[model samples]
Target: MPEPDEICGVNIAFAVVGSKWKPTILWVLAGRPHRFAELRRAVGGISEKVLAAQLRELERDGVVCREAGAGFPLNVRYSLTPAGVTLDRLLEPLAEWGHQLQRGR
Candidate 1:
């Protein structure tokens, strides 16, 4: 097992993804890159402003990429970066763990 640099990793993990809607955002975007509106739609219940801020934070943390898209509206899409890709891979099992805990309850 790898020893964590921080004594409390749960705190750190929460710091990264602890936002009300970030985990869902990451999960939805895991399938493919999404436009700003698309992410809001998929995430459900997040306000436009909050989603935009979270996306910016994700981009800053190297978790998401902001890219310009094609067409008339001049779309902007967000994709998981290499770091986010690795994080998504890690999150899958963590998701299962949460499900298992739900089952046990």
Candidate 2:
């Protein structure tokens, strides 16, 4: 099997983080796990339809894990998985870079 460095440069990974609202969403979750509504609010400006779609996609991508609670009204919460935690660590520098860019302006 070829190593990642052989197959591609870091651009592929950036593409993952480059997604719209994903960076902001991840930042919010880094603070604390949030349910659907909470995530939507934190991500502010994302439409409901799009927010739901993004959450589903994030869960599928293993960035977020969904836990369903047993209850009359189904309760579901989303938290960063270990994989996501690692990604968050990687993103910290990106966040700093963004800060620098803003400051430079």
Candidate 3:
């Protein structure tokens, strides 16, 4: 697989978080670890299949971590990894910029 660092930082960042639902996913998870259903609710319009696919992609990119518990009824939770935390920090300024742009518009 091609490594993200091999490319420009902006390209890699976009590759990881540029999808319609991904930045929202990262924003939600930045607050705290959440269960799948909770994330579904928090993210608003994303379907189960799409959410799962996005989460899988994020996990593959090492930006998100999934924890599974063993039992008759399994419990799973997702949280941001260190890299994800760094991305979240970066997103803060971008989000502010969006807000300022909207105000200007």
Q: TM-score for each prediction?
A: 0.85, 0.83, 0.90
Candidate 1 lDDT (Cα, 0 to 1): 0.85
Candidate 2's residue-wise lDDT over 1-105, tens digit each? 768785674675565666888877878888898888988988899998987777787787788888998996888888888878889998898789989999999
Candidate 2, residue 77: how far the Cα is off, in Å: 0.5
* Residue-by-residue lDDT tens digits, candidate 1, 1-105: 546766476676677787878888888889999988878899999999999899988888888899996788788889998888888888889989999999999
TM-score of 1: 0.85
Model 3 clash pairs are none
The parts of candidate 2 lying over 4 Å away from their true place are 1-9
Candidate 3: Cα lDDT at 68: 95
Query: What is the C-alpha lDDT profile of model 3 across 20-69, one tens digit per residue?
Result: 99999999999999999999999999999999999999999999999997
Among residues 3 or more apart in sequence or in different chains, the pairs in candidate 2 whose N, CA or C atoms overlap within 3 Å are none
Task: Give the least accurate 10-residue stretch of model 1, judged by summed lDDT.
Answer: 1-10
Query: Model 3 off-target regions past 4 Å?
Result: 1-7
Quote the positional error of residue 78 for candidate 3 in Å: 0.6
The lDDT of each candidate is 0.85, 0.81, 0.95
